[model samples]
Target: MDSGIGSQPLQEETADLKAPIAEPSINLDNRIPGLDDPYEHALKPNGDPWAILLKPEMETDKIQCDAWKEEVQTLLIFAGLFSAVVTAFVIESYKFLQPDPNDAIVRLLTQIANGSNATSSPASTSFTATAPSLRINIFWFISLILSLATVLVGTIALQWLREHQAYPACSPKQTLALLRMRSESLEAWHIPQVFAALPLLLQSALVLFLAGLIDFTLPLGPKISIPIACIIGLILVFLACTTILPSFQPLFLLSGRFSRDSVPSPCAFKSPQSQL
Candidate 1:
């Protein structure tokens, strides 16, 4: 009976302890301030301000399909240029392979000499190798001039394009200004290719002219061949010059939508934001 009474009192005390308690409220307004909000822009350091503007716009407006159009155009232009070069090579091969009168004369002379000089020396001895004169055609001289001119033009255009990339676009106004700048850019980008054509065309013309000029009747076969050889040598020189010069490659070739102003963001890749 005594044990039951003691356990009853302990149970009541445990129940009392388990009951919820209401504590008095205390006021605390103490906190430390952080350095600054990272989102609040005070000019985040970046190489391109145009990209900065583009990121925000891309997040808001989505459409990057226009870039595809620019890419296609660039590829097409490159393909056309490549095809032209291939065609030139084919034409050069055709001209070089064509049969000439000089070969026939050389053969005929060898046969006549073999029959005539039958005593001690063979008659074929009289058909010794003959060379043409070294007088170059006016056409070849003109072609050389054109080749040098084209090389000069290509060099100038490459330099101009390099200089155009130095300016920065920090604002929407500046971005729009680049649209105007593109006029200058186009000249820089296009002039090189145009100039390169001069040399290529000249070389092709000279190659054709020399191939067509092999006359067996003309005196000094060796001397005549010299001009053609020089023309061929000059063609090689011009081609070397072109290989060294920076050919035009427009930025739109990568992505036309990329301007001095904007580019598609990784997340907003589909957004087509205009530079202006």
Candidate 2:
């Protein structure tokens, strides 16, 4: 009887407390009311996702994206210059791949003179490739090709970045929503990752060129080639050290990345914010 009385008070307390209401679920498919007809931004050809952005986040992301774009431009510039330099080397190196007619004639003459007294026939005047020449030419050609490819990819990436900056919005109030959509789209499509890879391609081209240069100098005697080889070796070691330093110390890679101005937090995130 005592237990039943205690349980009756607990049941009464439970009945007095009202059930908690559920939070409304987000509905992305529904068109936002009072906005212009271009509400379905995600489905359009130049689609931007419907964005819910905090103003501060939008501003900060803009700064980071802008900095990243500038970096790509700089990379393109360097790639162009490097490609020209590689082309110059390529022009010189490619000639060695083919047999020189003058050299064939010289060999013929030397053979005829040496066989003047012998009754045996002279050797055939066919060209043969030397190991060092073949290796150097192959290395340099690949390097030149890689550098040119970098320039080409850089150009395409820059164009994509340019096209992405514009937001598709019919009304001025929808500006913030559109901006956030475009920013999200950029990240979703992996544009930043593309920018990151450009440097790696350029670096590969540089390494190949250095290897080819080493092969080219090695043919000369120890007196001349030794000094050149040592200097190049030192350069390779320095580049390797600098490249690896970033893995050990990440701050070195991220230094000076931020812009001088602070990113202003204009407002908090809202679906279709009034002002962009």
List the candidates' TM-scores in order.
Answer: 0.28, 0.62
Best by TM-score: 2
Q: Candidate 1: deviation at residue 22, Å?
A: 46
**Candidate 2 per-residue C-alpha lDDT over 1-276 given as tens digits, one digit per residue, 9 for 90 to 100:** 999989998998797786676889787767556645555335556434434234566578778768767877887888888888888888887778777868756766776786663444445566777888889888888888888887888889878866766566454347676666877887899877777777777877888888888788876778777887898889878666665544444353348554558652322322111111
lDDT of 2 at 198: 76
Candidate 2 C-alpha error for residue 30, in Å? 15
Clashing pairs in 2: 176-276
lDDT of model 2 at position 236: 79
Candidate 2 residues lying further than 4 Å off, grouped into runs, are: 1-58, 107-124, 246-276
Tell me the whole-model lDDT of each prediction, alpha carbons only.
0.46, 0.71
Question: How many Å off is the CA of 18 in candidate 2?
Answer: 24
